[model samples]
Target: MHDAISYLLFLVGTFLAAGVVKGVTGMGLPTVAMGLLGTVMPPASAAAILVIPSFVTNVWQLFYGPSVAQLIRRFWPMMLGIILGTVGGAALLVRVDPVWSGCWLGVALMAYAGYALIAPAFSVPAALERRLSPLVGLITGVVTGATGVFVMPAVPYLGSLNMSREELVQALGLSFTTSTIALAAGLFAHGAFQVSQLGTSAMAIVPALIGMWAGQYVRMRISPKRFRQCFLFFLIALGLELASRPLL
Candidate 1:
């Protein structure tokens, strides 16, 4: 009984911390949550618990920006690719070993963190946006489906578009929303999402929202640049830890 209570408390605290990161940076809920929870549970289970909260939070972000219609119109192809790729990739999730999945996730996290730290200045050419968007979406979807972490080629692809900060945030929201829904569908298809898990996922929303609120308050006070550096460093460490688990 005590162990159960402790686990529940850990989950609440995890979501709260993840929420604060998302509230401040407009992302990181799943990455942070999965990183921490994967230590306690299977990777697939961690991903399962993230479904509802990730969707709700990204939905909030999706509507908070201007020109939703325009954004949708521009990114529909990528969205479609995301759905297809996720469905395909998620089919593998149920069959893969948990340790392997954790290693894959860890590698992905490290790669993502490394890329972010390098901070390349390249942008997608206007001419190539039409050609490259679907590919990016497909890749991102596959990664998300396989690892339950969605922020690879997609985030970089979106950043390459050179949208204004507000537009970029909204675009991320849209991408994340699409990823969350597709992830949920994949999990359902694999029979990984049980009713009991759904209840836990739903309850997590409260703490996530609370953390978001607190994070928003902190965002007003801190330097985003500095915060991001710290966040990425943490991810790098977490990624290393996750990657080493298979060997351990």
Candidate 2:
């Protein structure tokens, strides 16, 4: 009963954060949700529960936000990299230790969060940005497949690009959607898809959507600096949680 109560609390808090992240930044459901969920559940289960909601939220972003087609066309090479990397990552996940994988993910995310904290300006030259973007996609795709922590690489890349804030948000949204599809397929292939879990995930989507709407509202009131700060703080907390879980 205690464990059950903890699980319920985690689900509620995770979705609430998910919504806020999505609403404010127009992306980050998986990052925020999976991060929080990592504290209470195994990384695999955390990824599982987040999968459906992340997909739904990103789908919503793709439709509601600016010119997704143009963005996709501009980044097809990155998309292909994601596809290839995700397949390879999924294969590795089946063969390795998840705790070790989680540790690496936590370290990477902590580093990314640190970078976000210190960077005063987020601008990359178009030529270098274009060349680096696919590498980010490839790393993110593999990480997404293995640990469900796929937001790191692309977040900085998107931030560095010359797109408007809305466009950056949409790009993250689309990337997550692609990852969710790949993860779902990989999980099913690995026999990790549980009917009961799927049903639970479906039910959780309601609160997740609500939280996203709320987050969008919150985003307008906060400055970008504050948003980045809060985001970094959250990442640190999540990273510590991930690193500590195995020992605890």
- In order, the Cα lDDT scores of the candidates are 0.90, 0.75
Best by lDDT: 1
Residue runs of model 1 more than 4 Å from their true location after superposition: none
Residue clash pairs of candidate 2: 19-211, 19-212, 23-216, 24-215
Clash totals, every prediction: 0, 4
What lDDT tens digits, residue by residue, belong to model 1 across residues 1-248?
A: 99999999999999999999998888999989988888788788999999999999999999996768999999999998898888788866667888888888888889888999998898889999999989989999999999999898899899999899999999999999999999999989998888889999998999999999999999999997888889989988988988998788
TM-score of 1: 0.98
TM-score of 2: 0.87
Error of 1 at 241 (Å): 1.0
Residue runs of model 2 more than 4 Å from their true location after superposition: 1-6, 120-123, 128-131, 222-224, 245-248
The true-versus-predicted C-alpha distance at residue 244 of model 1, in Å, is 1.0
Clashes of 1: 0
Q: RMSD of each candidate?
A: 0.9, 2.5
lDDT tens digits, residues 59-148, model 2? Answer: 887666768889889887777777667766765555456676677557766776787777667677887867887887888788777777
